[model samples]
Target: MTLPSAYTEAPARRFNVGERVRVKLAFPPGHRRTPVYVRGKSGVVERVCGAFANPEELAYGFDGNPKRVLYRVRFRQRELWSDYAGSESDHLELEIYEHWLEAA
Candidate 1:
């Protein structure tokens, strides 16, 4: 069964499939969704995963208003790890929020 969402509409997306983007490297003292290893790494947007409540705020008991766009990004394994010894086509996919990404 489909459940009604609290948000009336999805937030505007800042990226599209195949667009190159970089993860923001900022580290704030609070709950975060973005991982440390992926910070500052460049990747391509594989697909749009739609917008959802901001978990960081939700974790702190806020209403989680202003939904954020989430994306599935594709990063080459070699680019993430300098000593990676996988095939050239090897890559990693991560679900990153819009606030954690920037133009590459």
Candidate 2:
């Protein structure tokens, strides 16, 4: 069995803090990290966590290029978890990569 390569090894550009963006979840049949709780959710750029090598590439026996970018995206609890119990002002933080975001 083989899995499709949905992501590339290219490093992505960094986004500014407080930038508004959306998260695009990439889930395959057998394994995934992006939880079902936050698929296609919108959020704000929080902190930049730096570079991360492609885990999928490593698993596929390919030493792909390291992906350099930011992480820790903050989203409103109401925006992600639909049944969020916290106040409207409350937000959630996610360690997202550059590829997961798009203009919202």
After best superposition, candidate 2 residue 35: deviation in angstroms?
2.1
Per-prediction TM-score to the true structure, in the order listed: 0.87, 0.71
Residue 21 accuracy (lDDT) in model 2: 82
- Candidate 1's residue-wise lDDT over 1-104, tens digit each? 11343433334788977899999988888999898989999999877778889999999999887888988889999989999998999999999999999999
Superposed on all Cα atoms, model 2 deviates from the true structure by an RMSD in Å of 9.7
Could you say which candidate leads in lDDT? 1
Q: Where does the lowest 10-residue lDDT sum fall in candidate 2? A: 1-10
lDDT of 1: 0.86
Q: Report the number of clashing residue pairs per model.
A: 0, 0
RMSD vs true structure, all candidates? 5.6, 9.7
Candidate that would win on TM-score: 1
C-alpha lDDT of all candidate models, in order: 0.86, 0.66
Which ranges of candidate 2 are over 4 A from the true structure? 1-14, 25-31
lDDT of 2 by residue, 1-104 (tens): 11333433334565766778887765666334456777788877666666676555566676745654646678788887778888999877777757667877
